[model samples]
Target: MTPLLVGVLGVFGLFALMIFRTPVAFAMMIVGYFGLWILEGSRAASAVVLTESYSAVSNYSLIVVPMFILLGNISSAAGFSRGLYDAAFAWVGRFRGGLASASVLGCAVFSAVSGSSVATAVTIGKVALPEMKRLGYGDSLSTGAIAAGGTLGFLIPPSTGFVLYAILTEESVGRLFMAGILPGLLLMTLFISTIVLISYIDPKAGPRGDYVPLSQRFKVLGRAAPLLAIIALSIGGIYAGVFTPVEASAIGAGLVVLLAFGTRAINFAGFRGAVLETLKTSAMLYMVVIGANILNPFLAVTHIPETLGNALVGWGLGAYGTLLVIILAYVVLGMFLDGLSMLVVTIPIVFPVIQQLGFDPIWFGVVAVIVIEMGMITPPVGLNVFVVKGVAQDVPMATVFKGVLPFLLAMIVGLLLIIIFPPIATFIPDTMFG
Candidate 1:
């Protein structure tokens, strides 16, 4: 069989495994190794696997992955998310649908620290949803807001998705992180605006609430200082060249540890849990990266991407047309696959095509992340919606899905703005690094 045929089969088979309830990492690893053995002889494929695994794991740049994860784990353990949400509430909670708006902004801030959508959804939903219910917010609107907002974790700075994308594409991780900043904020604003508009049109959807006292507001803000400090130090240190991205991660992790202690939030038991969780999660990320690294070379040998890329470019779809195709593909895949796994599965093939079509890699990374964010809130496998449902078990699944629709529309707008303007995502990265 032609190598191209083998590559195509591998792609479909990987999806089949995922649909059959296989773990994403295991499915990718199995298909990749098996495909390699078929394309080359088993002996050659085994040797390549051994060497690639070692090289991928030993690469020093990868240490940033664990450092960032550790930072997030520590912050989560320290209860930083609650402070962020509280502060956001104090500032925004007086508006009609104010709590829902606060949920979006709060999720954005918590996302900066946690960088995991499920974590953001559950954490914020736990804290914010019941409050919204008590305040008479509609169940659909309340559940949907948190579920949709949680997806910001993937697009925002300090994002694990962006980090993984940069590592795979060999883009500058710092620049990718920087590129995410504005677009992330833009999406957050869009989400908040959507909430306000919905509440304004149908006041019954979200009731107005009493404002927090100025003194209490200040107290909430004070509680958020540590999180704000860590965000500023980590992002600012990298941008200022005071430290490399890796060093910034180390510094961030260190700060989170200190914050945990300062807050007296981490007992020995909590600390051990944080460490073990970070270690376990980090291992999973590394395994996926290593497996993708092994699989990428095999895909390359097939020349399938090159063949498809040239054909699409020859079709003269122009930049926008090509981008539409990519986005459409992501939307479809979002239904069946988890976002990170979808990214890994497609990026090796798709990124080269994007670069060939003259799109900036950093900009494309942001665009790609936004597309994946859609998947997280989209059905029938919207991961974020499921997370929200877990938090509000009595809320129907359909209601959770319904809640995300407006934000999803806002996300669509945000994605289009990034596409047309480009600089919205690229400006910071270019100015800082250029």
Candidate 2:
């Protein structure tokens, strides 16, 4: 059989495995292993798996994943996320749809530490949803805000998306993280603006909230200061060249651990739970990374990415036209695939095209991550929407999906602005790393 045919079969087998409920990690691993065995010898295939698996597990830069996850997990366990949420509510809960706005803000803040959308949504939803409901905030608006806000975790600093993108493309993690800073904040602002527009159109949908006095607001802010400080020091430190990503992760994790125990926020049991959860998440991410690494070499041997890049550029579309096509394809893919799966499956093919078109990789990373974040809330398989529905079980699934529509549009707007003005995503990274 021709190598091109082998590549085609391998792609189908990968999808078939996913269809049959094989874990994405293992699905990629299996296709990669046997694809190599067919093309190379069995000995080479076996060696590739072992070497790649070990390489993935032992990579020094990857320590950021586990440490950052630990920081977020421990912060949640210690109830620090609650303090952050309350502070947000205190400041913004008085305006029309302020509760919803505060939820988005809380998600953005918590995302700085958590870096996982589900965790951010769950953490904020638990604290924000009940209050919004209590204060007569509409389920659609409130739940939608949290659901969309939670995706900030994918774009903010220390993002899992950036980490995976870096790993796949061999880009600088710090530059990618810095690149996301402005765009993440922009998306967060757009989400808030959407809430304001919705509330204005249907004030009853998100009634105005009670205002807190200044002294009381500051008091609540004081409660949230520790986590905020840690977020600043860890993420800020990275931007300031004070620490590498690995050191920043360790410092952030260590500080959160100390804050948890030192303030009596968590007992031994809670600490254990945080550690266990971190291990599970970190292990899962590591496996996906390993799977991608293995699968990529196989794809290269098949020359699929090269072939695909050639095909895309050969379509006679100019650079921007090709990019538009790529973005549209991602939107379609996002409807069915989760964010991590999309990143792993598509970036190898897409990254080459991106480079060919002369788009900045860091800027495209932000663009790609925002698109993935949109997928997290897109219908048919909106992961974050499902997560929000899970949290607000009394709220109908349809309502949750309905709620995210405005935010979804807001994400698209943010995406367009970035595309039109690439500097929104590139300026910070360029200034910092230059």
| Candidate number with greatest TM-score | 2
lDDT of each: 0.87, 0.93
TM-score of model number 2:
0.99
lDDT of 2 by residue, 264-372 (tens): 9999999999999999999999999999999998998998888888998899999999999999999998998899999998898789889988989998999999999
Per-residue lDDT of candidate 1, residues 1-434 (tens digit): 99999989988888898889987777877888888899888987888788889988987777877887787777777778788888999998998999999999989888777778887888889999889989989998899899889998887777889878987888888898899899999998998899889998989999987879999999989989888898888889988989888898888888889888877988878888989999998898898888888878788888878987998888898878988988999999999788889988889999889988888999999999999999998999999999899989999998888889998999999999998999999999899999
Highest lDDT against the true fold, candidate: 2
Q: Which ranges of candidate 1 are over 4 A from the true structure?
A: none
